[model samples]
Structure formats: C-alpha cells, structure tokens
Target chain A: MPRWVRHRYASLVVLAVVIALLPLLFPSSYYYRVAALVWVSALAAIGLNILMGKAGQVSLGHAGFFGIGAYAVAIGPTHLGVPPLASLLIGAVLSAALAYLVGRPILRLKGHYLAIATLGLGVLVALVITTEIRWTGGPDGMPVKKLVVFGWRASGADTWYWITAGMLLIGTWLALNLDDTPTGRAFRALHDSEIAARVAGVHVDRFKLQAFVIAAVYASLAGSALALMNGFVNPDQAGFLHSVEMVTMVVLGGLGSVIGSIVGAAVLIMLPQALTVFQEYEHLLLGFLIIVSMIFMRDGIVPMLAKLPGRRA
Target chain B: MSKQSHFKTLFAAAAIALPASMMSFAGTASAQQTVKIGSVLSVTGPASFLGEPEDKTLRMYVDKINAAGGVAGKKLELVIYDDGGDANKARTFATRLVEDDKVVAMVGGSTTGTTMAMIPVFEEAQVPFISLAGAIEVVDPVRKYVFKTPHTDKMACEKIFENLKQRKFTKIAMISGTDGFGASMRAQCVKVAPTYDVQIVAEETYGPRDSDMTAQLTKIKAVPGIQAVVNPGFGQGPAIVTRNYAQLGMSSTPLYQSHGVASKSFIELAGPAAEGVRLPAAALLVGDKLPDNDPQKKVVLDYKKTFEATANQPVSTFGGHAYDGLNILVEAMQRANGADPKKVRDEIEKTKGFVGTGGIVNMSPTDHLGLDLSAFRMLEVKGGDWALLPPGT
Candidate 1:
C-alpha cells in the first residue's frame, strides 16, 4: 500500500474512533452540542487551511462564504421553498462561484494588499447581510428551518453531533488525499516560491484560484451545518471578526496539517467554554491562555507535538 | 516507518485530553434540594455594558433570595455562562443551562441577538425564560416559556408619540441609526405614527458609528414646519446626535430619543447638549423622584438602593431588567409552591400587577409582556440629570 493511502486511513480511523468514543464521557447532551460546534468550526478551518496552509495564501474573508451558506439554508427554506439539504448544496455552489469570480482579481495581490482586499470583501458581505433587513432580518438575524432528511428531522445535539462529526471526517479525508494530488502539489510548489513554481510551469494563478474555490465550498458546508444545528442564522456569521477567527484557527493549528486544523478548531472553540469558570475575567484569561500556548508551541499544538524528538515522521 | 502511528497517538491523546478537561469542570453533583436557575449573558464582549450590570444584578438578587431563606424552601443555585455577545455561544450555553444544569427557570439575554438565539433552546426544553432584551419579537407571538422585562421599542415609540400628542405636536422629523435597534425602533415609530396623529415629514439615518449627524440634522432642519426631531438610536450615536442637534441650533424644535438611551451614561455623554432632550424610560431611572403614591415607587427605590450598594456603581435600567426578570421568576416559583418548569411557566404567564423596577407588570395568556404605555415614564434631561415628566407632558 502507498504511504499516503496508509496515512489517510490512519487519520480517518483515529478521528472516527475519537468521535465514536467521546460520547462515553459526555456527561450530558450539552457536550454533544459543544462538540458539534467544534466539528463544524474545524471543518471550516480545514477549508481555510487549504488556502493558507497548502497554497500559502491568506484569506481574511472566508466567513463571507460561510454567511452565504448559512443564509442560503435560512432564506431557501423560508422564502424559496427549497429543502434545507438542497439549499446547503446550492450555498456551496454559490460560494465556489463567488470565490472564483472574486479570487481572479484579488488573489493576484500579495501579502498585506491581498489581506486588505479580502478584508474589504468580508466587510461588504456583512454590510449587505445587515442592511437587507427584509430578507436577512438585519443584525438581529432570523431563525432557520429545521433540516429534514426524508422522514427524519435533524434536531437535538446528539443528531447534529453525529452529522457534523461525519462531515468533518469526510472533509479531513479529502484534505489529506489532496496532499498528493497534482493540484495539491502545485499548491505546495507555489507556496514554497511563486517564481519557482512559475518556472516549473505549475500554473500558479489557476492553482491558487482552485484552492480558494475548494476552501469556499468547505466554509459554505460548515456554515450550513452550523446554521442547521443552531436553528438560527445571523450576519455575525459573516463578519470580519469571524474571518479573523478562521485565520487564527488555521495558523494556530499548524498551517498545512489537516489534523492540526481540527486541533486548532477544538482548542479555540473549547478554550472559551472551559474558561467560562473565570467569570468576568473570562476574556482576560482566554487571551492569557492563547499567549501562553503560542509561546510554548509557536508552530501550533499538533505540529509542535508531532515534531517531538522521539516521534519519527 | 509509517507516520500514521505517530499521528494516531497524537490524535488519541488530544481527543482524550480535551473531553477529560471539560468533564472535570462538568459541575460537581449537588443535593437535589436546590432549585437551579441558569443564565446566558453577553458579559464580556461588546454588549457587556448591558450584560455586566445584568450579571451583577442576578448574582446580587440570587444571593439575597438565598439569604431570605430561599425560594419554595429550596436553596437557589445560580449557573451563569458569559457568551461574550456571540449568538452561537449563547445558544450552546442555553443548551447547557437547560440540559446539563437542568434549570427550572432561566433569566438573562442582554441583547436582542442573544435573546433571539436562545429562545428556541428554552422553548424546546420547556424551561421558563425571562429575557432582558429590548426587542418586541421576543414576546410578540407569545412563546409559552418566554417572557421579557424591558419595554419593547414599539412601546418606546408609542410613549414618545403619546407625549407628542399631549403637547399637540403633529409634524416631526426622524434621524435614526441604521443599526438593528435604531432601525427597528424607527420602523415601529413609522408604523405607529399615524394612529397617534403624528406625521413624520422628514426622515434621515446615520450609521451606528458615525460621530457627526450634522448632515442628517441639517436635512431635517430643511423641512418646513418640523415640530420636533426624534433620534431613535442608542450608544454614542444618540449623544453625538444630541450634540449635533445643539450645534445646529435646532433647540426651538423639541428633541425626542427612544428608551435605548435610558442610562446615566447617555446624559453624561451628551453633557449640556442633553438639556431638554426627552425619552421614554423605566421607573428605575427616576426611583428617588417618584411620588409616594406611585405603585412602583417602593419596588424601584428598593432595587436601586440594593443594586447600588452591592454593585458599587449607579444603577442602570439594563440591570433593572434583570431585577424584574428574577423577581418575576421567583414570584412564579413561590406561587407554584415548587420549581417545576411547567407550573412556574403557567404561574409566570398568570402574573398580574407585579410591581417591579421596570413597572407594574400584568402578564396574561395572550400578552407575554403585560406592561402597557403607562409602565413607561417620559423623562427629560434637565440640568444634566433625568427629570420625570408628568403624565400629560
């Protein structure tokens, strides 16, 4: 068996085992809800990792795609009479198309200029969602219709837990497999050096756009999952702060590592919950904790641990 | 050597460590004799101004209730989660409150967004939830388990219009913020204006963060016979608008603000420009000034004194909303003789003439928020302080 295939099978098995076993320790359904959130957030971070980690491109506007998916599920069922599942698919397609259109021009810019352009895109999406109060419910947001799969109604934390966990596994598997793909190799080549990749005839721009499009689909799917699970959608889902959060998760989880992205999502999502015990000092303590973690493991938790002397790659 | 083994070990360790750490903090087992009350508030983020006071108020009141020999003869146990103004986090905390803590009653949603997010969780769990948010949508359709203490934006508009009617002023211009609270209040005012014999001849909007509303005010000033200019916004925007209105020398036309700026900070922020500015607010702001004959006088004064003494800060109407929410829930729990969620919900629904910091609440089957226009007190900023206006004008 190929080494990459074995690696993919191993990661999937471990993730599946963790998902299957975590419930044994969950004292109540609330943990399931929280875990579901971690999974959904991780899925988005993994999508972002493809752009940031694999392609060495930064996107601060990923949440705009997330908002599209969330609103699609919300507006589709309520106004368009489309099924929630179908709306999720439609959102992904829409996000991919938008990413392609927008990435063509903005992705050409590098570093801070590209960052600023993406930031503007995110702010614009948030403004539209907030101003279109008639459809989007303004800043107060609107309730999403319950996702119904055939005869089964997707409600409850436990149901969403299984669904989101399954989705995360698939997302991780796809990301892991992409590591060895021709497009994935091209992304890595461009990430190493754009000029070098161009000299090697890697079609740098096309690969960057492809990574952006794939990342958008991932974010859109994650957003739909979250909206469905929460039974609500709001403009904050697409806000600039959320985009910053996605980038933070990717960077903190070990940039290009699939497992690292998931780990980063888990830490960021769960740390706040854990730190709620600090009462009014919650934010202060959270900041302190993040600073401490970064000081100890600068390359992110998973990557730093995996690089331990005894662990052979 | 396969890299898979190393990855597998790391994954297993992480997965176990994360849940294990969370489980350690899963709340220690308590005796069943305690009545659990859960709350999810935006205590640490942008809306912390509302939630901080609310959190302080709940902790103070719960301690007071427990010291007063507890509600329904069972100790009151409070479980609170600060959602940091994130609606998604608020929803998760709501689930934890309902499922993990198994709270019979819940209070606290400092903002409209947080309240709206948690409404479904409480409704699905059949837990009695009294919100402190200022949105009308919270109790409009009357969800069985949902109630609110704060006056809705619609009531604010109505009270202002009623004041306008008393003054016999029909022509008005509106400069509203384009944010959620401002936009919704503006819409409510527009919807209810004709019924009050008021016409909004000129209308303009300012962004939430805009420092100067001079341009909008200028446009409103251009309109002929603009009797009064109403600014329906909260935060620093209203204060800036007040300053801009003063700077523009539009004092001849009376200025009105919504209940969103019913805090001492608004008066402080607007400074001398706030003079003669009128807005609808709760009785809590004018607790010391209320006549002896008023029904809410004693309740309002007592809450003010206790909250001020304990919190070490002047009381805010936002805190008063939490005060009202808790008292309503406790009173319902006392009447039901226990903390059974269904009984408490029904009792809360049947609450009548319960004097609170906000006003005299009279809930019913159809009306979740039973306070009428009478509950709102029209106050004018006089000499850099709130001065209660008489019922008519």
Candidate 2:
C-alpha cells in the first residue's frame, strides 16, 4: 500500500474513533452542541489550512463564503421555499462560483496586499448582509428553518453532532487525500515558490484558483451546518472577526496538519465555554491562555507536540 | 507510522480531559435542593455594556433572594454563560443551560441577536425564558415559553410619536445609525408613524462606527418643513449626531433620540448638546424624579439603589431589564409555589399588577410583554440629567 494512502486511512480511522467515542464522556446533551460547533469550525479551518498551509495563500475574507452559505440557507428556505438540505448544497455551489469569479483577479496579489483585498471582500459581504434588511434580516438576523428529510426532523443537538461530525470526517479525508494528489502537489509547488512552480510548468494560477474554490466550498458547508444547527443566521457569521477566527484556527492548529486544524477548532471553541467560570474575567483569561499556548507552541500545538522526541513519522 | 498512533492517543487524552474537567464543574451533587436558573448573556463582547450590568444584577438579586429564605423552599442557583455577543455561542450555551444545568427557568439574553438565537433551544427544551432584549419581534409573534422585560422598539417609537403628536410636529426627519438597534427602531417608527399622525419627511443613516454624522444631519436639515429630527440609535453614534445637530444649529428643529440613548452617559457624552433632547425610557432612568403617586416609583428606586450600590456604578436601563426579568420570574415561581417549568410558565403568563423596574408588568396569554405605551415615560435631558416629562406633554 502507498504510504500516503495508508496514512490517510489511518488518520480517518482515528478521527472517526474520536468522534464516535467522545459522546461517551459527555455528562449531558450540551457537550453535543459544543462538539458540533467544533466540528463545523474545524471543517472551515481545514479548508483555510489548504489555502494558507499547502498553497501558501492567505485569505482574510473567507468568512464571506461562510456568510454566503449561511444566508443562502436562511434566504432560500424562508424566501424560495426550498428544503433546508437542498439550500445547503445551493449555498456551496454559489460560494464556489463566487470564489472562482473573485479569485482570478485577487489571487494575483501577494502577501499583505492580498490580505487587504480579501479583508475588503469580507467587509463588503458583511455590509450587504447588514444593509439588505428585506432579505438578510439586517443585523438582527433571521431564523433558519429546521432541517427535515423524508418527514424526519434533524433538530436536536445529538443529531446535529452526528451530522457535523460525519461532514468533518469526509472533509478531513478529502483534504488529506488531496495532499498527495497531482493537484495537491501543484499547490505545494506553488507554495514553495510561485516562480519556481511556473518555470517547472505547473499551472500556478489554475492551482491557486482551485484551492480557493475548494476552500470556499468547505467554509460554505461549515457555515451551513452552523446555521442549520443553531437555527439562526446573522450578519456576524460573515463578519471580519469570523474570517480572522477561521485563519486563527488554521495558524494556531499548525499550518499544514489536518488534525491540527481540528484541535485548533476544539481549543478555541471549548476554551471559551470552560473559561465561563471566570465570569467577567473570561476574555482576559482567554487572551492570556492563547498567548501562553502560542509562546510554548510557536509552530502550533499539534506540530510542536508531534516534533517532540520519541514520535516517529 | 508511530506518529499517527501518538496523535490518536493525544486526541483521546485531550478530549477526555476537557469534558471531564467541564463535568467536574457542572456535576455538583446539590442539584436536588436548588432551583437552577440558567442565563446566557453577551457578558464579554460588543454588547457587554448591556450584559455586564445584567450579570451583576442577576448575581446580586439571586444572592439576596437566597439570603431571604430562598424561593418556594429551594435555594436559587444561577448558572450563567457569557456568549460574547455571538449568536452561535448563545445557542450552544442555551443548550447547556437546559440539558446540562437542567434549569427550570432562564432570565438572560442581552441582545436581540443572542435572544433570537437562543429562542429555539429554550422552546425545544420547554423551559420558560424571560429575555432582556428590546426588539419587537420577540413578543409580537408570541412563542409559548418566551417573555421579555425591556420595552420593545415599536413601543418606544409609539411613545415618542405620541409625544410628537401632542407637540403637533407632524413633519419630522430621521437620522438613525445603521446598527441593529437603530435600524430596527427606525423601521418600527416608520411603520407606526402614520398612525401617530407623524410623517418622516427626510431619512438618513450613519454607520455604527462613524465618528461624525454631520453629513446625515446636514441632509436632514436640508429637508423642508422638518418639525423634528429623530435619531434612533445607541452608543456614541447618537451622541455624535446630537453634537452634530448642535454644531449645525439645527436645534430649532427639536431632536428626539430613541430609548437607545436613554442613559445618563449619553448626556455626558453629548454634553450641553443633549439639553432638551427627548426620548422614551423606562421609569428606572428617572427613579428619583418619578412622582410619588406612580406605581413604579418605589420599585424603580429600590432597584436603582441596590444595583448602583452593589455594582459601584450608575444604573442603566439595560441592567433594569435584567432586574425586571429575574423578579418577574421569581414572582411567578412564588405564585406557582414551585420551580416546575410548566407551572411557572403558566403563572408568568397570568402575571398581573407586578411592579418591576421597567414598569407595572401584567403579562397574559395573548400578550407576553403586557406593558403598554404607559410603561415608557417621556424623559428630557435637563441640566445634564434625566428629567421625567409629564404625560400628554
């Protein structure tokens, strides 16, 4: 068996085991809701990791796609009377198309310039969502219709846990598999040096655009899952801070590790919940903890831990 | 090869450790004798100004209640989670409040967004939740288990328009912030304006973060026969608008701010420009100024005194909303004689003549928020302080 394929299957099995087993320790259904959030966030981070980690691209406005996905489900079900599940797909497709249209020009920029451009894109999306009160419900947000399939309602936290966890597994599997594919190699080549990849006959622009599109789909799917699970969608879901949060998860988890992305999501999501015991000092402690973790794990928690002695690749 | 196995171990250890820690905190054995009331407030984010006082008020009152021999023979245990003004987190915390804390009743949701996000969770859980938000949609469509303490923006608009009608100011201009509160109140005002014999002659909006709104004010000033200018916004935006109105010498056309800026800090921020500015606010803002014959005077004064002394800060209407919500829930619990959610919900629906910090609340089966326009007092800024305006003025 090829090493990459073996590693991919092994990672999937481990993740599946974790997802299946975590519920055993949950004292109540509340953890399921939180776990579902982590899964959705991790899926988005994994997508961002592909762009930031593998392709050496940074997107500060990825939440724009997320918002698009979220609002699509919200508007589609409320306005167009489409099924919630169908709207999720429609959102993904719309996000992919929008990414493609925007990525061609925006991907030409590099570094801070690209970051600023992407930031502007995210702000514009949030602005539209906030201003278009007729459809988007403005800043106060709109309720999402519960997901129903064949008369079965997908409404509780436990059900959403399984749904989001299942999606995250598929997302991680696809991302890990793509890591060693020809297209994935082209992305990595471009990451190493865009000039070198171009001289080596790699389709740099095409690969960059592909990565962007795929990442947008991931964010869109994640956003749809979140909105459906929460049963509400607001403009904040597509705001700049959310975009920064997706990037933070990617960077804090480890730039190139799939498991790292999941861990990062878990840490960021769970830490705030756990820190609620601090009451008014919650944000202060959260900021302090993040700074402490970053200092110890400069390369991110997963990579830093994996590089410790006695670990074998 | 070994790296994968190591990661699996790490993942397992981390997952187990995290939840185990959470369980240790949440799994205390005192669940039987205590009436658990859960809250999810935006206690540490953009809406913290609303949530911080709310958090303080709830804790102070819960402690006081427990000290005074508890409610229905059960000690009150408050379980609060701060959502940082994020809707997603609010939903998650609402689930935790229901399933984990097993709270029979809840009394927090600082912002409209957080309150809306949490509604489905509490509804599904069948727990009675008293929200502290100001959006009209919360109670307009009336869900079974949901109630709110704050006056709706629609009511605020109606009260302001009622005042405007008395002043015979039919032609008005609106300069509102584009934020949630401002936009919502503006829409509500526009919808109900004609009923009050008021017409919005000119409309302008400023972004939430804009330091200056002179442009919008200038446009509003340009409108012909504008009898009054209404600003439906909170925070520094309204203050800037107030200062800008004064700067542009548009004070000849009376400036009416919304309940969104009914606090004393607004007067401090806008300085002398806030003079003669009128808004509809809860009785809590003018506790000292309320008439002795008023039913809300005693309740409002007590809440203001206790909250300010304990929190060591000036009381805000936002905090008063929390006070009203918790007291209303406790009153219902007392009448029902227990903390059973169904019984408490029914009792809350039947609440009558219960004076709170906001006003005299009389909830009913059809009206979740039973306070009418009379609950809001028209107040004007006089000498950098809130001065109650008499009814029909």
Against the true structure, whose lDDT is highest? Answer: 1
User: Can you give the TM-score per candidate against the true fold?
Assistant: 0.97, 0.96
Q: On residues B1-393, what C-alpha lDDT tens digit does candidate 1 reach at each position?
A: 246545543553365346444664657586698999999988877788899999999999999999999998999999999988899989999998888888888999998899999999999999999999998999988899899999999999999999899999999999999887898888889999999999999999988888888998988888899899888988889999999899999988999998999898998898899999999999889988989999899998898899889889999999999989999999999999999999999999999989998888999999998899889998999998999997666
lDDT accuracy of residue A229 in candidate 1: 92
Q: Candidate 1 has which clashing residue pairs, if any? A: none
Off by over 4 Å in 2: A1-6, A310-313, B1-28
lDDT of 2 by residue, A162-276 (tens): 9999999999989988977999899999999999999999999999999999999999999999998888999999999999899888888888778789988888888888877
Give lDDT tens digits, candidate 1, residues A212-290: 9999999999999999999999888999999989998888878888888888888888878777777767788878878
DockQ of each: 0.47, 0.47
